[model samples]
Target: MAASETPLRLSDRAGAQAFVQNLLAVMSELESALGRESDGVRAGRIAEAMTGAAAKADLAAAYTTGLETAKANAIALARFAPEGLEALKTAQRRFAAVLETNQQVLATARTVSEELIKALAEEVGKAHTPTVYGRPSHSPSPYGRAGANSGPLILSRSL
Candidate 1:
């Protein structure tokens, strides 16, 4: 059996409690980071939001390790610290919801950015295309320009 599934000695119970506590703390930090990222994206500050990536990655790794330990020590944890186990479960649910919001916000940012770029490109292409017979027959809009199936549209989504 894993340590979590095994019966806990007194010493092991203390260790298991500590492990659960650490996991909870990490989950709390992750929730905060996700909240910040979500706020930044909502406010159109994606660069600022991206700054949280490293902190999120580090906290996620720590949380994963602590979670594994907690699982291994589940039996001991339940026996010695039922309340802490329940708290961890609650925190996990909240963290999951925050993560979902973060995903939605980031996706919105990506879509808005792409649309803005496309619109700007179309406007600029229109300005540069020489007028033919007093109309922009050669200008590029959302539709293809004259004499071309469609002007080259290159998009770099590295962001």
Candidate 2:
């Protein structure tokens, strides 16, 4: 495996407890960040949805480090910080729920965007089609024709 996949060294019960505590903290922060991103995207605030990416990336790294330490010293943790282990289990369940919700939201966002783009494309195609009768229908662009092409929309699938 990669260097980052290597388990962290653990010398004692205290180290085990620290690892669990650190993982718990990471989970909490990640949960909050996911909640914000999910809500922001659902509400169409795309910029707000993207504000947590950097924070989530850092938290993910910390989470992995702590989990590596925890998995390597599971026996030691059980012997020393059994209560902390229980807390970590509960936190994991809650985190899992948050992740599920976030996943659903992101999936919905993708579907909505795809459908919207397809519908818009069809409309544009129809507008440009030659007609035997009156003028072809034309809808005013939201950002104006020039402004619409000023930048591309970027959506990241990762949280």
Cα-based TM-score, every candidate: 0.73, 0.76
- Name the lDDT of candidate 1: 0.78
Q: Which ten residues in a row have the lowest lDDT in candidate 1?
A: 1-10
lDDT of 2 by residue, 1-159 (tens): 266665676667787777777788888998999999999999999787888899999887787767767787788778888998899889989988999999999999989989987787666666564544576533458766522332344445553
Name the runs in model 1 displaced over 4 angstroms: 1-11, 133-135, 139-159
Q: After superposition, how far is residue 105 of candidate 2 from its true place, in Å?
A: 0.4
Superposition error at 7 for model 2 (Å):
3.6
lDDT string for model 1 (1-159, tens) is 345754334346677677677778888888899899899889877788889899999988877767666776778888888888899889888888888988998888889887999898888677666777887666455664453543666776455
lDDT of 2 at 19: 77
Report clashes for each candidate as comma-separated counts.
5, 0
RMSD of 2: 7.5
